[model samples]
Target: MFCFLIDIITYMHSNTFHIIIGPTIVKSIYSGELTYDSDQFFRTGNTNSYYYQAIDIIVNITGNYTVKSNSTIDTFGYLYIYSFNKTKLSINQVTKNDDKSGSLQFTLISALQSGVRYIVIVTTYSPDVRGPFSITVSGPATVGFHVNTAATKPSSSVTTTTRTTTTTTRTTTTTTRTTTTTTRTTTTTSKASTTSTTST
Candidate 1:
């Protein structure tokens, strides 16, 4: 004769996927999921427990979809989800596991929306060292925020030009009287003329 003992924790979300929140052992929990023991701790103290929603999604024709779950100072780490932004979406933080072992999952669901994009960023808090928040995205993909700053306009358009010019005019006159030169009838005359050129 022989006796054996094992444990497993499986959690499911409506309209979403399933996850093993605790130890994943291949055993038949034929004791048949012992009644939810109120005194039973999922892990330990505030450092080791989490709460999750039974339902995973709600969809709107168009808009932003956001989901979030935070962790205690003890169990802060990367946040995980099923898939990101079937439409525009945002994912918040991670919640702790009861035993100082696991983390919580937050889910946001939405239909495809026009002119909108989605992304999920996974970041860590104190005591838990991880890389910069991992980002997941779809449709106009990005690893960062998208606000479409380039599409904005400041004001209407108008053009202007300027021109300047200067002009100068000069006048002069010369008069000669010759009443005495007619008496002699033999007057000799020589006239010298001077010329000047002006440029503009």
Candidate 2:
């Protein structure tokens, strides 16, 4: 009798599941203009004067952001946290940049946080420069830009009321006149000169 051989077979199966996480990027652009009416500030240790515009930054996500400017004027950028004081040019400053992508534009990279208020100042490298400037901010989420309205003074309005009474036998005459006076101060300065003039 022939011996029977026993054979054993085994089978195995394997499976894998993978998840990839990537960063989210969002871009926002703001178009603004700088004129003689724009806010002015002097850089530290420099007698040169500059006209600037302060923009309030509000973010929805916390991440690194790239803030850039596109303008014909030589642009200078400053990033600040909490508040931005025009007089105190260096206080609370997070970062600053002069030029990065050429065209005399400035690019500033900063780590921004959510729930925190930030300020971005766009200025010129040269003194008394004014023009149109566009800003682009790219981060994890879109951001909101609010121009600092405190730089512009609010106009006040004055109202006057007049009353007149007349009798049957007599007549009354009344004259009402309103006069408005506006006073402005003009100043002239050079790159190396700082002179102010007030006109009354």
Candidate 3:
């Protein structure tokens, strides 16, 4: 039995521009800074004019989760998992690095469900590129169960009994028993990979 719970919420960089940088709850390693008027309200559509800044993570324990971002320039990483009274916008993972060498990274591996609440968005794909960024979350704190058992025995057994008596005396006895039962089922399948890296 193993259980590990992590909750981290931090936001401190204020000049009043709609502060809400984090729904904030991360397992480990969170550092922040994204300039050029930080809040853009998370809208991705209509021919690219980038604007995104969001952070909110709450994953109590389910299994297989990783959200990563490292930046110093050209950055873009977005991973979202909602649906806890926030109207449902579940699991959207995005990363950018379209032929610009390096320095923007995003990695995500899903399969999370145990008190679920996730929203991580770090911007600057293009639209006033910023500086200093670091976000990290590693996997497997819990959510694993495995049990297997198999048994079979009884190779040989034989018994015979008969009785007979003479002159108005008679006895009869016969017994035979054999039993076997077997059932088996097994299934396994797993695959999780989401990674984006750029270096310049």
lDDT of 2 by residue, 55-109 (tens): 8888888889899898988999999999988878778999998988698999989
In terms of lDDT, which candidate is strongest? 2
Candidate 2 achieves a global lDDT of: 0.75
Candidate topping TM-score? 2
In order, candidate lDDTs are 0.26, 0.75, 0.49
lDDT score at residue 46, model 3, on the 0-100 scale:
46
Ranking by TM-score: 2, 3, 1
The sequence of per-residue lDDT tens digits that candidate 3 reaches over residues 1-200 is 23233333334321212212212233455566665555543234443345445666566677666666666666666565552111222335433233233445656657777875566666666775666666666554422211111211111112222222222222333334567888888898899999999999
For residue 59, model 2's alpha carbon misses the true position, in angstroms, by 1.4
- Model 2 clash pairs are none
Estimate TM-scores for all models.
0.17, 0.64, 0.22
Of the two candidates 1 and 2, the one with more favorable TM-score, higher being better, is 2
Which whole-number lDDT from 0 to 100 does residue 149 have in model 2? 47
Q: Return the lDDT, model 1, position 26.
A: 16
Clashing pairs in 3: 23-55, 24-56, 101-199, 102-198, 102-199, 102-200, 103-198
